[model samples]
Target chain A: MREFALIDRLSQRLANRRADTRLGIGDDGALVAPSAGQELAITTDTLIAGRHFPVDTSAFDIGYKALAVNLSDLAAMGADPAWVTIALAAPELNAGWCDALLDGALAAIGDASVDIVGGDTTRGELSLTITAIGCLPAGAALRRSGARVGDLIAVTGTLGDAAYGLQCWPTRDNATRDQQFFIDRLARPQWRPGAALRGLVNAAIDISDGLAADLEHVLSASEVGARLDIDTLPTSESMMRSCDRETRLGLQWSGGDDYELCVTLNEAQLDRARAAIDCPLTVIGEIEAEIGLRAFDRHGVRWNSDKARGWDHFA
Target chain B: MREFALIDRLSQRLANRRADTRLGIGDDGALVAPSAGQELAITTDTLIAGRHFPVDTSAFDIGYKALAVNLSDLAAMGADPAWVTIALAAPELNAGWCDALLDGALAAIGDASVDIVGGDTTRGELSLTITAIGCLPAGAALRRSGARVGDLIAVTGTLGDAAYGLQCWPTRDNATRDQQFFIDRLARPQWRPGAALRGLVNAAIDISDGLAADLEHVLSASEVGARLDIDTLPTSESMMRSCDRETRLGLQWSGGDDYELCVTLNEAQLDRARAAIDCPLTVIGEIEAEIGLRAFDRHGVRWNSDKARGWDHFA
Candidate 1:
């Protein structure tokens, strides 16, 4: 397949003809109109072949994850995704591969409306980049520097399933229901619909680099500290059945790729926020006057912070 | 250098905060507010190590061109560039290389008034991707689809200089003034300042893949054809002095990477439009009812359109 053919296929699948998208696909650049008082939120991610994911992974999963990861950033900012630009590099183009990739990418944006506006396709080492553009009300973006003392630290959805899935993928068993659930979570992460809680949340960050590391980013940015209640971590039935309590806790704290939002707020209105987005959120900790992370078990004894080594791409 | 440290270096150079940019660099995504009555224009480009530029080319030039190429797209759409997101991948990060790269990129945006918003860094084969976002007045974007049958075909600045420079690069023979001029054009292309002609122009496109191929895109999109007076082609002093008439014409017709604007309009207000942008504009052809390119030399004899083979990535 030729590059233009691949681009043509991608453009056709990504076309949505939105009114605000003044020009899309075949133009030198995409033209979009933002309504007055709405601010544009732009995020970019580059997924490499071997470093970010296993080379044997399906194009479908790669495509889905590529856009999913980028959208996760917008979600952290409480922005509604509207458009995406992809820069794709590959050794060669295969028709079936391209089709599967688009199928997964199109399905990834199932409800949260977004149009693939403009992009670049070229020949190179296998790498896919996505820049997701979204919008929010001016001065209403959820930032990492907003957490204050006494705010409740919460997370949207269950954590650590993706990391568990990655560990189990080597075996490729899937004999138990737990394996499938874990793998699915890794391959296709569901983004939290917490954009509605923009004003309610004091600070937010998407969990890509383990819960501990990502939360640290918020704390450092806000110049605050966190006290995580280890026993309060939200876990799925599959997660609980698949591992011991200490192992589950380790994964919850250190396993990355959750793509869930770690949010902080002053009030304990998680029920309302969860209902607003139809997603489960658990209050796992609280912002403190301290300067660093302090994790405690049910007995209120602190867990060693040195044990949590979060995912770092370069490292 | 670590990814975060490299990002810090980049941020320090690219930090020229603007009012509309609510958040930049260190955030999950950049937050920007486009003024009312303006539409956002966005484009993305990826430059592979061996394909787009020589593997041995200076990192500074690579970084500058990476953003310059994307900005050219905005220039074609007649948009005012504002924000950029960059994704960089390299086998290894060298401190000197990073400094030079950012220096060149920051210098490239001189007086263009843009901010490096947010991006990613990863370890992989050498490649760079840039997504530039700009804005234009609503309903006033110059598009390739707006050309009329009688519109005059014009180009900005001189052509064939970059192609000449590229061909002359291997020898490293900058002993002559002409060779140095050509090589400089290849390394640092000046994007035409025709965005000011938005209201006055019917259609516009940036010449990256040579005039013949790029102009064909505009013609096909506009559902029109072009008739070119080959003798009227703009030529730099060095280009004319260095090459014979036939070789110079070939470079003019098929040489890519000029980064100049090829704009079309009907009324003969060339001087006014040229004065608006302070860029030299030369009329070379006319849009016609004909179905394809028709070129004429000084003798009025038609030059075979088949000879105008333009650059194709996949070809």
Candidate 2:
């Protein structure tokens, strides 16, 4: 397929024509009118085959994850997703592959009401860079710098499933139902909108570089510390049955690719935040006045985190 | 360099912290408030090492052009550039290489007052994807679909220099002064702000895919035709001296990578547009009510354009 033909197909199928879109695709630049009094939230992420994911990953999964990761960043900022621009570099063009990729990308935005405004496509090693734009009320963004001492640290949904899912990916075809669940989690990480928890949460971050490392970012940014109870970290029944206690704890703290939001909130707002967030909420830590992150078990034994290395693309 | 360290260095050097920026780098997303009564103009472009440029090209030029190409798109829409997000994937991290790349990128935005708000870094075949966001007054954007039958088609600056420059690129060190000029044009295509032309031009497009092909886009989008004069096509002094008439014409019509603006305006508005646009302007065609683009010489001899193939990424 030619570039124009591919672009036309994408424009027709994926263009989310919203009321605020003055001009969508087929222009030099997309023109969008943000709602008055709302600050635009922008984030970018790139996924490279063989680096960010297995090279054998399906086009559908690649496209889905590419957009999902950017939207997850928007969610962590307590912003409502408004638009996305994708820059795709593919080694070659295949009609069926393009169709599947577009389908998966559209599926990723299911019911989020965000638009695909504009993008660039060229021939290169298969990679996707997606920049997502969202909006939030002025002075209401859930920043990492807002994590105050004494705040209760909470996380949404079960953790470590995606990392466990990677182990089952290669044998996904012959996998058990529980393994299929883990594989699906690995391929398609879920992200909840943080807009509803804007006032309730003091700080928020998406868990992409494992729970411990990401919480460390919050601590550094907010100039505070955290004490995480490893036993309280949420885990699925499938995960519990699939691994030993030590393995489960290690995965929960250091396994990456879980797009769930890890938030810090005041204890008084716990009930309100639970009512506002439409997902499983578990308090696994607390923001402290100290200068570092510490983890402990249910038996009050200090768990050494010195050896827990998080995901690093350049390392 | 580790991922976080590289990120810290980049955040310090390239972040364009504007007053409207509520949050910049270091957060999940950057937050910026656009001025009221303005529409956001967004565009994205990607430059791959082997595809967009030579594999041996310096990181500096690649970085400069990556952002310049996106800014050119914003200029075509008569928008004032405001912010940008960069997603860089490199095979390896080198400090000097990274520093030069950042310097070149900053140099490209000289006096444009645009800011680097957020970005992503990863490991892959070297590639840079920049998404530029600009703003324009509501309903004042120059669009490709706005041409009229009587509009005078015009172009800014000389054409075909970049294509000619490519021929001399490999031996640029031994180039003559004139050859060096052309080489500079190829490496760094100049883009002017189109904000002043917002009220003057009926339609506009940047000449990236050669003049003939880009003009064809305007004709197709406006549902009109054009009569281009082959003899009236502009050429620089070096271009005129380096090639014969036919060679110059071919390069003018079929050669790509000249970031000049092609615009259509009324005869009455021509004087105002010329005054408003900072670069040299030349009229090469006229919009017709007929169905397709046609070219002719000064003697009214029709020039067949069927053989002029435009640049296509897939083809």
Candidate 3:
């Protein structure tokens, strides 16, 4: 059997009626027209085996993570998930594995309320590239360039849990309940934020490359600086007990893969946001007029060196 | 160096300005607002080393061909090229090689009048994926299902050139000027008729999977059938002289990588299309009421049991 034959078989399994999809598989591209009063937001991410994840990772997890990361981007933009197209490359055709991958991905899509529109599958080393399309109300997207000086910088939920979980992967010392929670957070993160912050947040970004680095992205794009209050940065008691203070703070501030939404809001809206969201909201910093970031200790003195580096892709 | 660092380095080279591009390289996703009154048509394709192309192929050619194939998809959809995003994976971070790839890709974008909006780069096995977004008039897209019974099936440019070129790759005995032309076509095919066929074509698709298979896709999607006149299928004089009659006909009918538009049109529009396009339009078949495809030789006998197959991704 050839590649086309494999695709034909796979496509048969994928054939189903979708209301919004004007056209599906077997064309040059999928065609879709957005509903009235909604604008489309599209994002693409690629994951390569043995680089993005371990080769031993299950196909189900790979599918779940690929869709999860893309959905995180949509959440950051304050857009409602809509559609996705996947371009998959694998060394060989394993029908059972492919079915499981699709099942996992479809499960994620069901949770996100997004549809799999169309995509291409080819033979190569295992790699997945997914482009997600979302929809937002007219003039309602929260962009990175909207932050202003004196605004309160905030983050959703706890940070560094995922990084700490990764560290635990090397040594399976503790099989405690808290340790299992952290491990699950690293493996399958859920970015299910409350809808109340949709129009309230001014500027937002997902914490993929750690707090320090991702915050830098928002500040730089907004043409402003920030001053993080070191003591106010949120972390769990389990993370604190597992690692030393310095390591805990470093991982919390610079460790990536948390997938939490880092947002900036006006000082006046802070109270309303705190009351609305189910997850803990911490005002870790404030937007500043300066050109770079600074972290201050509880005593109001600048803590640590200004050369804090987060997870760099090519580092 | 880490994967994110490599992305940062490559991203700097892709940073530039375009009026239509709402956002460029460094965000969760690149955002673009198409011109008013235009509909966006998006397509993505992935090329892997040792699969889509030979590993020894030039990086520049690989980059150029990657974008070209996506552009061919847009052309088949009767769309005006607008923007593209590339997700690249490689085993190593060679700055010079990456620069060369970008240079070739940018050149092709310039020629096609498309903008490089954003992309992601990571370290992995060599693979390149590109998602192309184009704009077309609000309701003028040429889709596969739009073909009607009695519609003439026409193709742009001669076929079998790329297949013959691949045959000559091992032995340079056929390395004449004509063979070189075919080789160039295999490496970098130019899409024909350009955006001129947008409003005129009833149904169209790019011929990347050879005429036999790709045409079958159109017929199947449209719930119609076709009777191809094998003698009417276009074949270059050089190809006919170099290969046997059966082989020449097989290449012309089933050769992949042509990138030419296979279109279906009403009889009334034939004269208008002939006047608009520079390439010769060969009417090789007509849409029938039944489902499936058939071919007839000069003797009016059906040409069944074709052994020539198109490019398959899984084989």
Candidate whose DockQ is highest: 2
Could you give the candidate ranking by DockQ, starting with the highest?
Answer: 2, 1, 3
lDDT of 2 by residue, A158-256 (tens): 999999989888888899988998988888888787888999999999999999889989999999998988899999999988999988888889899
Q: Model 3, range B222-270, lDDT digits (tens) per residue?
A: 9999888988888877777788878887887788888888999998999
| Model 3 agreement with the true structure over A176-291: per-residue lDDT tens digits | 86787677667666664533577788888889878888888898889999899987888887887777877887788788778888999998898888887768889999999997
Tens digits of per-residue lDDT for model 1, B195-313: 68888889999998899888888998898888999989999999878999989989999899898999998667676777777677889999998888898899887877576667656
Report the poorest 10 consecutive residues by lDDT, candidate 3 chain A: A304-313
Q: What is the lDDT of residue B239 in candidate 3?
A: 79
DockQ versus reference, model 3: 0.50
Q: Residue A124 lDDT in model 2?
A: 93
Ranking by TM-score: 2, 1, 3
| Tens digit of per-residue lDDT, candidate 2, span B1-315 | 888898899888865647787778899999999988999999998988877777877878877777777888899999999999989899888888888888878878888878898999899999999999998998999999999999999999999998898887887879998898888887777887787799999999998888888888899899999998988888999998998887888888888888889999999999999999898889998999997889987788776656456777998
Model 1 scores what on Cα lDDT? 0.85
Quote the lDDT for B106 in model 3.
73
Q: Residue B61, candidate 3: how far off, in angstroms?
A: 1.2
lDDT of each: 0.85, 0.88, 0.77
What DockQ does every candidate get? 0.76, 0.89, 0.50
